[model samples]
Target: MPIGMILWRWDYRSGAEELGKYPKELDVSDKTMMQLYSQHLYGAQSDIVSMYVGALNIISVWTGSTHNYFLSLLLTIEEQPEDYKEVISDLLYYLIPFIEEDTFNTLLPSIYQRCTEFPSTNLEQRRAMMYGSNLNRAIFKTLSEEGCFYRDELKIWLEDILKTKLYNFEYIIDGLVQNDILKTSIVRGVDGTYVFLLKYLICFRAPPLDLSQKIKIAKDNELNQKILKKIRDFFKKYVPNEQDNIEIAGYIRQTNYWVIIDFLRKSYAKHSSLTKLKLHGVDQVMNLVNNLINSDIVDIVVDQNEEQVYFLKSDIILDFVPMNYMINQIYNMHVEDRKPDKLLLSYISILKENYLESH
Candidate 1:
C-alpha cells in the first residue's frame, strides 16, 4: 500500500481507545522508497516519498481542533511497544517543524515526562533519552533560528523548561554547564538565565578574577564598594574555590533585579504614576533601574528640582493594558468564569483616550 494510504487510515482511525495503532503492513519494510517500489508493493517507488509528503501537507493545513487531535494520536503512538515506535519517531521528526509553537509547547512537556518515566528495559530507557533529547534540540534550533523578534520568547521558554528539569542547580552544573548548547552561538540573542549559566562555569571553575582586577572594579567608589562587598560575600560563602562562582553572583543579581522589578510592577499597578521610586532605599538595584529605563518599559523623568518620577511607559499601557484592568478581569474570570480577553481588549481599546487627546 502507498504511504499515503497508511496515513489516511491512521488519520481516520475508528476506535478512540486504540487511536494511534494501525495495521502492521505499514511497517513491513525498513528499506528505502525505491526498494519498496522495486518490489512492486505500492506501485511506483516515488510514491513513497510523495505520499508521505502529501500526508504532512494535509496535517499542516488542518484546523486547530483537527491538528490537536492528530497530535494526541501521535503522542499515544509514541508510547506504544518498541515495534511501533519508529513510525511515531519518524513522523515527529518531520512534523515538529510544522507544528505551531503553542501546540509544540503543549505537547513537549508530556513527551519529556514520558522520557523520564521508568522504562521497562535499558534499551527502552536509552531510546527514550535519545528521542527526547533530539526533540528538545530540534525545537531549540527552530526557535533560535526563527527571527530576532522571537529571541526573548525562546529564551524564556527554555529557561522555564530547564528549571522544571533541573530540580537542583547541581544538575546544571554537572551536566549542561559544559555542553556546547550553552556556548555563545546558541545563546546569542537570549537573556539572563543562559548568561548566568555560562558565568557560573567561568566564575567557579575558571581562574578567579585577579585580586587587583577585582579591586579596580570596586575602586574608591562607595556604591561600587557596597555592591562588590555583597557579591564577594556571596561568593565566599557559597562558592567552592575549585568550582565556579559565576552562578552565585548571577543568582544574587537576578534575585535583586526580580525584587526591584516586582516592587515597581506592584507600584505601577496601584498608582499608574510614581513621583518617586525612593532609589536611595534600594541603591543596590540601581543597575536594574537603569536597565529598565533603557528597555523603554518604564519612564523616569527628572524635574528641575531634581526629584525623580517613574511611570510605566505609555506604550506598555497601550500594548498590554493596565495592570489594574488585568487584575479585575482575572478576578472576574476566576469567580465567574468569564472570558477576560474580550473584556481586556475592550479596556485596552479605550486605554489611550486621554493620552491621545493630550497629544
Candidate 2:
C-alpha cells in the first residue's frame, strides 16, 4: 500500500505550524535519513513518503511540537493494532533522548495507557533506553540500575559496560544531567574542574507540587482512630476487585503485606526520587499505586521498565512527623464489606509510629 496517501490524508496540513518548524538552513539531506533508517526503509519510489514522515516525526520529538507523523507513531495502538506493543516500545527506545519536556509529559500518559494492553514486559526497564547507543545495549544501564557510587566509580563502570574508552565523556554526561530527565550534583575541584555526578532522575509520573499542597490542606483529619480498619480493608477490598485475583492478589495481605512496608523502604533508597515497585503482584500493586497517586500519597510514576515504579513524597517526614501526612492519609478511605484481618489491624499502628522506620 502507498504510505504517502495515508500520511497526507492523516496529516495533510497536520497543522499550521508545519512550515514554520522546518527552517531551510538546517541543511537536512535525503541521504542522512536514508542511511539512518536503512533497516526500516529500502531505496524505492515509496521512500519519498517515509522521508517526509520521518522529518515530521523527528521534528516533533526534538521541538516538542505535535504534527501528524508524530501523532501517527503515538496512536499506533489505535491505528495499527497489530504488533502495537513492539512498535511503541521501539518508539520509546529512541524517543527519550530528545523529546521536549512538554511534549513528553503531556503525551506519556496516553502512551502508557496503550502499554497497559499487554502483559508485563520487564521489571528491569531503565531510563537509559531513551539515549544514544553505539548500536548495542544502552550505555547508561549501570547508572540507572545500580545503587549509590562515587563519581570516579561511575566513569569506570560506564567504560566496563560499554567496553571501550570514553574520551571527553564529560560533555556527554553534561547533556544527560542537564536535560529535564535527570539532574546531578555539582562538585568543583581544587583546580576549578567541574564534575557532574548523577543525583536522581525526575520521574515523569510525579504529581505537581500544588496537588500535594492541596491534599495536605483538604485532608487534615484523615488519620483518626478508624485508620486501622481502613488499612486492613485496603488489602482486602482490592484483592477481589481484579479479574485474576490469584496472581494479582497473591501477596495482598495473606503474605503478611510485605509490599506495603517495602514501598516505604524504597523511599529511603539512595535514588530517593523514584521507588521501584516490586513486580510480584504488579497488576494489583499498580492498582494500589494509582489509588495512592490520586490520594496524593505518592508523587509520580515511571514505566520505563515496563514494570511501574512510583514516587512517594518524602518531605512529609522531612521536617517532623506531623499528625497528618501522605503515609497515614493512605488510611483515610472507607473499606468495603470484607472480614477484617487480625494481623493488618495491628500492623497499621506499627506503620504509623515507625513512619521513619521500614524493614
Candidate 3:
C-alpha cells in the first residue's frame, strides 16, 4: 500500500528570511506557523483519504519546517524522549501513519537545510519542490528491487508526485538537464517499443572524459577488477546470453569504481569478491576478467601463467545508487497499485538483476 498521510515538521527559523521576504505577509505567530503546518499536513492527508477512502491504504504524517528555532528540537526527535513523545502524540491523535524513526532521522536535516533556500514565490517552483520531495519518500520505499530507472518511468513518476503535466514539469527537469546530471533520450526496445529515457549523465560530466580515458583510469584503480567481476557475474546469472560487453565495459570505465565498490561492500558484503569466486568457479571468473580487459575497460598486467594480474588503468565508477534507488521505488509503487508501465518494469528488472548479481 502507499504510505499513509505523512506529517513532516521543520523549524520556523530556518526559513525566517524567506518567510519575511514572502510578498504576502505570512501568519508568523507561533500559532500561525503551527496552524499553517497543520493545515498543509491535514490537507495532504485529506487528499489521500479522498483518493482511497474505505480502502486498505496507509496514511503517513510528516511534520517540520526549515525554521532555525525548531532545529535543535527537530534533531532531538529521534533520540530525545520528550521530543519524540510530543511528535508521536501529534501524529497518533490524528490517526496518521507514524514516520519510521530512521526515515525521520534521514529527512530532518535535509528539510531543515532545504527550507533555508525556500523560494516560495513561484507556484511552479514550489510544486516542483514538492514533486522532488516525494521522490525522496519514494527512494526510502524502494531500496531493494531495482537499480536504475528508465526515462519514461521518471516522467510518469514526476507526474504523479507533482500531479501535473510535462510542460509544467519542465522547471525541474531543465535544471537537472542543464547540470549534466540528467539526460533524456529515446530508447528502442528489442520488441520495437520506443520510449523516452531519463538517466544520470554520469559519464557526461564537464570536460567529458572519453571512453579510453575512463578505461585508463579504471585500469589504474585496483578496484576495477572487483567491479568488473561483479558486473560479469551479475549478467551471467540473470541476463545470460544478453551481455553487451562493449556497453558494460564502457559503463564501468565511465563510472566511479571506488564508490560502487563501497556501496557494494555495504549492501552485499557477504558475497565479497573472494566468496563469489569460490561459488562461481575459477575458470568462469578468469574468462569474465579476460572479457573486461579485452573490451579495454581495464588494462591488465599479467604474470607468466596469465592468472595473477593487476589493472594498470581504469575509469572512476559513476554513482548508480540514485538510479538503483529510483528503480526500487518505482517497483514498490507498482506493487501497491500495479500501475507502473510494463516496459519500464522490464528495463529496471534487468538492471536490478544485473546489479544484484554483480554486487
Candidate 4:
C-alpha cells in the first residue's frame, strides 16, 4: 500500500534549481501515477495524483531560481481547448493540501488570484468555499461535524490572512467585517485597530517611522494613544533590549524567520557580487545573525572594526527546514505515537535519501 516509488520518482522535482534531465529509458505514458495510486489509496485516484503533482509544482514555483512552472502551467491550463473547467477545478482542489503554511499562510490570495482570471460565478463561489474549508481544516487540523467558523476560528483566519499583502486597510477591514470574517464592531475597538496596525508593520516590514511620526498619525484622527502603545509593545516583543543568543529555531518560528531568509536569498540571487545583507531592529539585529549561523543557511563574517555581515551559503540545501521538519514529524508519528502512515513515511524517506543525505 505504501507508494514509496512515487515519492522516490518525485524527489527530483523538489530542488530550487532547474529541473534535471529526465531518464530516457523510464516510461510514464500509460499511467501518470494516477492509475497506480488509484489502485492503492482510497478516494479518487485522479484527485490524489493531481494533488501530489500539483504540490510538486507548487514547491518548484515557490523556490525556483529563475522560472515559475506553476504560472506557466496556469496559462496552459486556462487555454485548454477542451476540459478546461474540470481541469481548473481539480487543480484548485488538489493544490489546497500541498500549500506551505509559511509560504502562502492563507489560501485567499492564491485562490483569489486564480478566481479573478476565470470570472465564472459558480466557479468563483465553489473555489471560495473550497478555500475557506481547506483554510479551516488547516487551522483546526480536524473537521467539525458542523461546518461553520466560530469566533475563535475567525480570529485565527484573520491573523493568517493579515500576514498576506493588504493593499488597502480600510477596504479590507470593511469587507471582512461585513462578510462576518470579523466581529462587526471589532475594527472600532482600540485593541483591534492596534493589532491590525502592528500586523501591517510586521507583515510589510515597512520603513520605520520615528516615535513622533507614528504618534502624530495615530493621534491625527480617531486613532490615538492605544495604537502607539500597541506598536511599542510589538517592538518590545520582537526587539531585544540586550544582546543575547536567541534560540534559533524557536525564534525563527515565532518571528517568521523564513521571511528574512527569503529576502536575503532573493537579494543574493539578484546581485551575485553582493557579499553581505543588512537588516534592522532588535539589538543591532538580535537573533537573525545567530539563527542564520546556526541553521547553516548563511555564513557569518565580522568586519575588522564594524558590524557583522551574512553571506548565503550556496552549497547549503534549500527546503532544509521545512522538509526536515516534515521528516521528523513522520518519524514521530510512526515510532512515538504507535500509529504509522507508511505511505507518508516512505515519501519522507525517499525525499531525504535522495536529496537530504548530505544534511
Candidate 5:
C-alpha cells in the first residue's frame, strides 16, 4: 500500500479529520505528523487502532509528555485487554528510539500493570515482570535515591513488596555502582556527621557562563582546583591505575569524534560548492563545532580515527543542530520567509533518517 494512502485511511478512521484539512502536499514537522497520527489513531473505534494509539501514548510519556494524551489513552486501554498486544507492539517500536535501557525498564512495568491488570496469562505475566525487572534494575543503577538508601532502609522499602533480603539489596546496589549509575561521595553534614553520599552518577551539566564570565568564575572560585581534585579522587577511588587514563580517554573520544568528522566533511563539501562564498567562515565553523562537541548531549570519542578526528554520536544531535540555529534565524526572518533554511532542513532530515534507520 502507498504510505500516504495508509496514513490517510488510518487518519480518517481515527477521527483526525483536521489532518485531512491540510493541503495534500503541504509539509509538516515530524512532531506535527506524529501528533496528528496519534490523535487519529487514538480516536478510532477499532481495536487495532486503539492498541496502536495506546502504544503511541506510552511513547509520548517516555519522551517527556507535553500533554496528558498518554494518561487519557491509558485510561482507554485499561478497559480492554484483548486490544493490548497490538498496542504493545506499537509502543515498543515508537518508544525504542526515545528511551534509554534504564528508563524503559523503570517505566514499562507500570505500563504493563495498566495494560493487563496484572495479567495472569503466562506469556503476559512473563513480559510484564521482565519489563518491570529491567526498569527497576536500570533505575537502581542510575538514580541516587534508589542507590544511596542503606540496606536497612532498602529492606524496609522492599519488605512485603519485594520479599527480598539484605544480601539481595547489596547485590543490586553493587551492580548499579558498577554500571556507573551511582557514585560515592564523602559528604560532610552541618552537624559534623560524615556520610558517604550515594548519588546519581551523571556527567556534570555545562556551567552557564560565557567566555569572559567563565574565565572570571574559574579564577574567583578556585573552581579549577576543585574540579581537578574531584576528578583525581574519583579516578583514584573507583579506577585502577592501569585503567584510569584508558577509561577517561574512551569517554572523551566517544563524545568529540563525530562532531570533528562532521565539521571536516561539511567544510570540505562547502569548499567544493558554488555556495562557498555564502558559507560561514572557517573560524565560525570551528567555534560552532567546538561548542557542539563540548555540549553535554554528546559522548566524546578519543580513539585513533581512520579519518583522524574526534566525533559525537547522540540522538540529540538531530534536534540540537537545526533547532539551535533555526529559532534564531526565524526570529530575524519575516513570517513569509520563516521556513527552515535549506541547509539546516537538509541536515535535520538526513540525521532523522539515519537515527530512525539505526534502531
Candidate 6:
C-alpha cells in the first residue's frame, strides 16, 4: 500500500492535535533556491526554464493556490509592465537581512534602498497594508483617539483587546518600527524611550506632503536608489546582462514574495494571534516540517493500514515550513468543514510515527 492512498483521518489517532500542528517541510535546497531566486542569482550559464520553474513553484506556494495557476497570473503581471514595481504595502513582515560580517555592509543598505522604493511603486500596496494586521488597527485607533501613544501605554490597551496577557509584545513593536509603519519621537524628560508619537507622525507627514508629491519624491528616490542598488549588485555579483536577468527573476521572486509572505503571515497570525518577525527572525530559522521533500535517506515501509512510513535512526523526517503554520491550516479547514486533505493525513501519520522506535 501507499501513503496518501486512502482517506486517513487525523482525529482517529493519539496526540491528534499535535499531529495536526506538525510543521510542514522547507527543504534547505528549496530555501536557498528561493533566496537566490529572489535576488536573481543563478548559475553562470543557467537556462531560463530552470528559473521559470522555480518562480512558478514559488508563486504557487505564495498564493495558496496551485503553482500551475501562475500562467494566467504571470501573463497578467506581464501585461501590466509597471506591475513589477507594485509593492504590497501592508506586508505583515519584511525580512531584515542581517549579514554575519562585512567591510562594506551592503546588505542593510540594500534593504534600506528597497524600502524607499516601495512607496514609489504606488499606493495600492499602502491601502492593502493599512488594514492587514490587528496590531496595525489598534495602533491606528490609539493614535487616532489619543493623538499619541507610549509603547508601554499601548500594550495595556492591547491586553484589554486580546483578553490575554501578550508575551514578547516588543517583537510586535519591533516589526512595526522596522517596516517603517511606525516611527519614533523621544520625549524630553520622560523615560527616554523614543516611541512613535502620533502628532510627530502626522505633523511632518500630513501638512507638507500631498499624496502626489510624496509619490514623486519616492519615485525620484527610487530611481536614485535603484542605481545605487544596481551598482552594488553589479560589483558584487558582476555578471553580464545581470540587470535584465534580475528583471525577469524579480517578477517571480522579489516582488511576489512580498505578496506571498504577506499571505503566509496573515494565515499564521490569524490563529496564533501574533504578528510577523517574532516567530521569524532575519534568516536564522531552519527547522523540520513534515511535508517537505527531503534528500535524507531513511526507512521506507508500509504500515498495517497499508500506508507508507518514513523512519530515520535519529527521529522522524524533518522538512521546514515552520510547524506552527500547519496547526493554523488544520484549524482553518476544520472550521470551514472542508474535505480532509490526503497529504495532510499522510503528514500527520508520518509525524506521529516520528517518536516510535520502529513502526
State each model's CA lDDT, in order: 0.32, 0.32, 0.35, 0.31, 0.32, 0.31
Q: What is candidate 4's lDDT per residue for 17-134, written digit by digit as tens? A: 2121112232332233433333223433222223233212211111121212121122222233222333333333334334423233244344433433333333323323323332
Please list the residue runs of candidate 1 whose C-alpha ends up more than 4 Å from where it truly belongs after superposition.
1-220, 239-359
Give candidate 4 misplaced runs (Cα > 4 Å): 1-232, 235-321, 341-345, 353-359
lDDT of 6 by residue, 224-323 (tens): 3433343234345433342332232232223333332333322211212222334443121112212111311112334344544332211111111112
lDDT of each residue in 162-206, candidate 2, tens digit only: 675544244345544454222343223222222221223221212
Instruction: Count the clashes in each prediction.
Output: 6, 4, 52, 0, 24, 11
The 10-residue segment of model 6 with minimum total lDDT is 1-10
Clashing pairs in 1: 200-247, 203-245, 204-243, 204-244, 204-245, 205-244
lDDT agreement of model 1 with the native: 0.32
Model 3 CA deviation exceeding 4 Å by range: 1-156, 159-301, 304-309, 312-359
For 121-162, candidate 1 gives per-residue lDDT tens digits of: 233233223223433343333323321112344445555655
Model 5 regions lying over 4 Å from their true place: 1-14, 19-142, 148-201, 204-257, 261-284, 290-359
Error of 6 at 63 (Å): 23
Per-candidate TM-scores read 0.20, 0.24, 0.21, 0.21, 0.20, 0.25
Please report the candidate that would top TM-score against the real structure: 6
Candidate 3 structure lDDT: 0.35
Q: Which candidate would rank higher by lDDT, 3 or 4?
A: 3
- Candidate 1 residue 324 Cα shift, in angstroms, is 57
